[model samples]
Structure formats: structure tokens, C-alpha cells
Target: MYRFSFFVALISYSTAINAQQIELRLHGCQTKSDKTYFCQLSNLGPIAIPAIEYNVTLAEDGRTFPWAEHRSGQEIAGGLEPGETMDLAIQLPTLPLRANEENVSISVELLPQYLPPPRPPADAPATAKTFANQVEACFNRSTLSSAAANGAIDVNVTGLKIQKVKNYVTDDAAAEQLFQAARRAILVCMSRNGTADVDVSLRFDGSGVHGLPSDY
Candidate 1:
């Protein structure tokens, strides 16, 4: 009977140790909108966990502040292993607490699911993955033409004369050409606006031009 009791006590101790082993920390929190708060949570342990269940509660009745309703949840993607942290950008949907209300303390709890060890970061190469594709799409006239052909960049022109220029910018030379063309158009518009020669020159940088008929 003594031996059995000793075994049960050992098991209880082990369970307590493991239960509190998982660490929980709040990275930061930001108010997104009157109704939403973006709470960022980070796991600062050296274990890759499959899932975590967390809860957050705010303090009530500080300085007689109005009661604010809060809803909390997680926006977790996959799991985090040891030495790797997970950033959960949670969007809390809640009604805004009135001003001059009580200061509130938020509480968070995390439950982690143990998984296999994490892979070394040295094996993963960080490169500009999207820039090349974006550049290629921008420079490929065929792609741009196809996109225009598909009405991706639709323009609804009514009164003004419309011109569609398809400039392929693959190399630096072509890019320079595109920039020059854009600059030339801007300069022409600026000259027209400054001299007031045109009836109406709308420079969209918060500038308006009223050209007199005799000024030109």
C-alpha cells in the first residue's frame, strides 16, 4: 500500500511539472477599430506545438468605467515548435468602452500540443520570391496586353480623348524609357496648368489651373 501511494504521488508531481511547462506571453496588443482589437501573441518556448487554446479576459469596474463587451479568439496558423514562436494576430470583436472608464488588465492562457522537433532555419533560404514575378509580369508586354485584353485594367472614358500606351519594360533601358514618357506627360500638363492656356487643367496633386483664353 505504501509503494502504490508513492507511485501516485510521483505521477501527480510529474503532471504538475509538465502542465506548467508550457509558457504563455503576450507580445503586444493594438486597438484596430472601435469594435476590433488586434492582439499579438507569441509562443516563446523551444517546442513545436500543433495547436493552442487560449483565453483573454479584461478587468471590470476600474474608476467606474462603463461595461465594455469583448469577444476573443485565436487566429493561429499551423503550430509552433520549440525555439520558434508563433505570432497570432487576433482580431477581437468588441464594443468600445466609454472614455474615462476604468483601466483594464487583460489575461491570456495558452495550451500547447506537443509535436515533432522543428527543422533548422539554415536549410531554408530567404529570397525575394515575389519581386521577380512582379517584374516579369510588368515587363512582359504580352502579359500586359493579355491582361488588358481580359479587361483587367478597365477604363471608362467619356469625353476626353483616350490613349492606351503599352510599353514593355524588361530591361533597364526600357524602364528608363517608360519613366521618361511619364515625366514628359507630367511636364506638359504642368506647363499647361501654370500658363492657364487650357480651359481646365486638373493636376491631381491638389493643384488646379484656370487658363484664361487670352493668356495663351
Candidate 2:
């Protein structure tokens, strides 16, 4: 019954992963543009998950503003890949006036609708530095490059904290190769921003490709 035992072990392993929790993290909010709030969130665990569904709030002077509950009731997001960081913006009518005030704090709460998963480990660190624009551009370019063969690959890039770069793609080999191109883009883009030598982290789905680990 060697084959029967192997099949039993396989089922047990599948059960374990499905029972595993999807990890998430919400970084701090920083003032972006003129009175707008922006933040970064990441998938810190071993699995590549879908877009995060969240609601945001601004707290200061004893007042709070909720983004999803009160504004834009519906959700629209493409989820963060394993080790990928997703950039989010909080919208509010009074932000233009309130943003000027110092010590403003933002709170982003995840809703149950997306069956939002538990957060990252308590000891897991958080970062705020981002290359959202560059990420969007790079993903777009990579998708375009892969289009001829793989059609439009869906992915999101986040967590570009200085000296720490990471992203996730459907195809590790193609994405790793394509995102290396993204790394060069970051080099040029960051150089203009007065930074250099940012290390990168990449992850993919499955037990990973043969001879291809998640990090590079």
C-alpha cells in the first residue's frame, strides 16, 4: 500500500495549508498630495493572496472619518501577492483642511466581507517608504512584455521600502526575469530620488519552480 500511504500524506498536507491563515499588515499613514492620506500594506506570510479589502479612518482632535462605510461603499482592489506591498489612499471631504493639522493619525480597519485574514506576526516589522508609481509602471511593463506569450498576467507590486524591494507574480521565472528589469527601473528612478543600492525580495506560488526559490 505504498501508493495509498503517499496519497494519504498528500491529503493531509493540503488540509494543513488550507487551514493556514493569510497574513496581512497595515503600515502607518503619511500625508500624500495636498491633504490626502496614503499608506502601505503587505502580505508577510508564505502564501500569495488576493487583494486586501479594507476601510480607513482618520483620528484627530476627537473626530473620525470612515472611508468604506461612509464613502465609496463598494470595494475595488486586486490583492497583494506573497511579499508584495499594496498602496492605499484614504479619501475624505474634510482632509484638505484637516491634513494641515499636526499629529493626525489614520486607522485602516479590514472588513469581514473579503473574509479579511489575520495580521502578520506581532514581531513582524512595518515600513512606510514606497515606490508605488514605479511598481505600477514596472508591473505594467512586465505584463506587456509577457502579453505576447502569456496574455495579461495579473499581479501587484508593493513594499519598496528603501533598500528593500519585493513583489509577486504568477510566473516566477518570467516575473523574476521581468522584475529584474523592474529593478533596473528602480535604480534609475531611485537615483533620481537621491537613493541607491536597494536590495530586492521576490516570491511566487506553488512549491516554487524547480530550482527556483522565492527570494532573489
Candidate 3:
């Protein structure tokens, strides 16, 4: 009975130790050939994680912020052996315009290439990932695209116009989610009046921060 109890305790300890032995760290690096930027994903864990083939998910409250966009909900990494890391050459997603600021975090899971990627709904278009970057860029560019508490959010684009409204409730939560999901503006508001609609106009410029022209 003494030997059996010791064995059980050992097994439990092993399970707990291996629960999340995979460690991930993000470092900003540039490639030598083209000088383009990439977020380096390092695996400083006991086990090897497949590179580019692994599954990655961002925690909204996580402190590590990545600048790349996940066209699909997840990305596939190549392989990362213990202490090995790989760089993802994609641009990061942008945070939405909001009254309150929050943090972002990331998590990755290993996926061997032998398995197939997840399939979208049958009715979904193939080009869904293409707009992901555009959506993120738009999120930061629009001030009026988000709401303001205790006052009106007046945003005027260079060539675009803006309209004013009174006393809009400024909830940053929903807009932040919308920025992660789409390329347009989503208003989260509260009001004293019964009116529920306000017209907002904004544009996503590809020449702003992170969207700068190559010639320059």
C-alpha cells in the first residue's frame, strides 16, 4: 500500500508539471533579406511546438500585444523545438478606438501539419482573411468611430465629414470586439433620450501608421 500511494502521488505531480509546459514569448525582429518586420515566437518550453502549424489565440486582457493579423481565427506555425523560435512575417492587428484602454494577450497550441485546417461555414467567402488587416487599421484611424462618455465624439476625416450628437454613452467594450472582428465601426452607447440611432462617417486610410507607403 505504501508503494502504490507513492506511485499515485508521482503520477499526479507529473500531470500537474506537464499541464502547460509550453512557453511562448514574442519579440519584434526584422528579416535580413528584405528588412521587413516580424514578431518572433519563441518556444522556451520542454516540448517542441510545430512552427506556423500551431494554433494561436489572443487573450484580450493579456499584456503581450502582437502586431500581426490572424486572417483566419487561428494560424499554423512550422515547428518550434524546445528553446527554438520562429518569426511570423505578418503585420499585427490594431486595437479599436475607445474611451477606455485595455490589454491584449496571446496563447499558442501545437498542431502538426498532418491535420487539416479548420473549415469556415459553407456560405462564407474565401477572401475573409484579406480584410482582416484593413479592419484593424481602420479601428485605430477612426475617433468618431468610437463613442465618448459625458460628451459627443466629434471626428472629421481629411476628406470625410462628421455629424454631431448629444450625450452618447461611451462603452469601449463592444467596439473593441468589433475591431477584432470586422473592418467597420460599431457603436456602443448609452443615452437618456429614447433615440437609438446616430449617423457616423469614417474612412480607413492605407497610408497611416503601419500603412505607410513603401516609397517613403
Candidate 4:
């Protein structure tokens, strides 16, 4: 009886872990002359995702221009399977001649195909501060000493706003590495805390990370 109980407990734990593991990667994005941008998304997790919702923003000098948003499940025939990739194309309004590639930013949100089992009441509630702390800690632990030696990386949290820093390091590869590391840490922390959405900003000052609240 004791052996059977232990086996069942282990299986349950494993299932929970698998259910919470979801990873989606944005391979690349490019703009076309027709005011449309195309991007490739890949499912890097064990589970399949039903669909994706994404927002594309065009901004310059802290001003945002009108842009189109898309939300659809029909893009994926059945679902996005593990190691599978799908293409996304979004149309935008005509932009001012001054608008350039640097003004474009894309944010993506994945929709799970199935809901995971409910968490027990004992589970701690998710908070933005906690999430930010987790991200900072994870990034620090994952980054190399040489890469982080010259610049300081800080993560701060407010209501729902999150800030990330860049432009301090001269090494493009190292900067990208830090950005990816912070992104992965945020994803994991959000998953554990059941955080649905967050607003992320990138700052060029090279100071540190900060968070604020969003209307969403």
C-alpha cells in the first residue's frame, strides 16, 4: 500500500511539472514594402498550443502610431505541436516616411490548448515584485561574470509594468544573451504564479530594470 501511494504521488508531481512547462520562441520578423510584417513562431515545449495572439506597435520619440492587431486560432490548422513552427503576417496602416524598422516592436502571447489542473489553496499568490525578484536572481545566476562585470542589471516591479535595460554593453551578443535570460526567467515566474499578462518596456539609459502598472 505504501509503495503504491508513493508511486501515485510521483506521477502526479511529474504531470504537474509537464503541464506547466510551455515555451514559445519567436524565430525572426521582417517588414515588407506593403506595410505588412511577417514573423515565425515555434513551439519549444512538450505540450501543444492551440493558438497565439500578438500585438505590433510602431512608435517614435515616445509617440505610438496606429497599428493593426491580430487574434486568431485558424492560423494553426490543428495546433502548434512540439518543435513545430508557424508563420504570422500582420498588416499595418501606412507609416510616415520617417518611420523605420527601429520603430517597430512586437509582443506575443500564447494561448494554451488545454487548461492545467487547478492549484491547491496552499499555493502562494503571484505578485509583480516577486516575479521581478525571480527574474533578477535567475539572470544573475545564469549570466557569466565577464559578461555582467561592466554593466549593472537591476529588476524592479510595480503593479504590472516591467522595465529592462540595454545599450550599456558594447557586445551585442552579450546584450542579447542578457535579454533572453531575463525573458526566460519572466516566463517561468509568470507560469508558476499564473500571471496572464504584463507590460514590458526597454530602456536605453543602461541604468536598470523598473516596473509599473498597465491598464490591462
Best by lDDT: 4
lDDT of candidate 4 over 179-214, digit per residue (tens): 555556666666666663644332211223333222
lDDT of 3 by residue, 118-180 (tens): 222233222222322233333444443222211122122121222221111223442333232
Worst 10 residues of 1 by lDDT: 1-10
- Runs with alpha carbons beyond 4 Å of true place in candidate 2: 1-18, 61-79, 93-100, 113-216
The segments of candidate 4 whose C-alpha lies over 4 angstroms from its true place after superposition are 1-19, 64-75, 93-216
Compare candidates 3 and 4 on lDDT and give the better one: 4
- In order, candidate lDDTs are 0.31, 0.38, 0.30, 0.44
Segments of candidate 1 deviating more than 4 angstroms: 1-20, 61-75, 96-105, 111-216
Q: What TM-score, computed on C-alpha atoms, does each candidate reach?
A: 0.33, 0.34, 0.25, 0.36
**Model 3 per-residue lDDT at 139:** 46
C-alpha displacement of 206 in model 1, angstroms?
A: 61
48-120, model 2: which lDDT tens digit per residue?
5543344445445545542212232233366456688777675633544434335444455643212222222
How many backbone clashes does every candidate have? 10, 3, 18, 1
Native RMSD of candidate 4 (Å): 20.0
Q: Is candidate 2 or candidate 4 better by TM-score?
A: 4
Please report the candidate that would top TM-score against the real structure.
4
lDDT for position 117 in model 1: 21
RMSD of candidate 3 to the truth, in angstroms, is 19.9
TM-score of model 2 relative to the true fold? 0.34
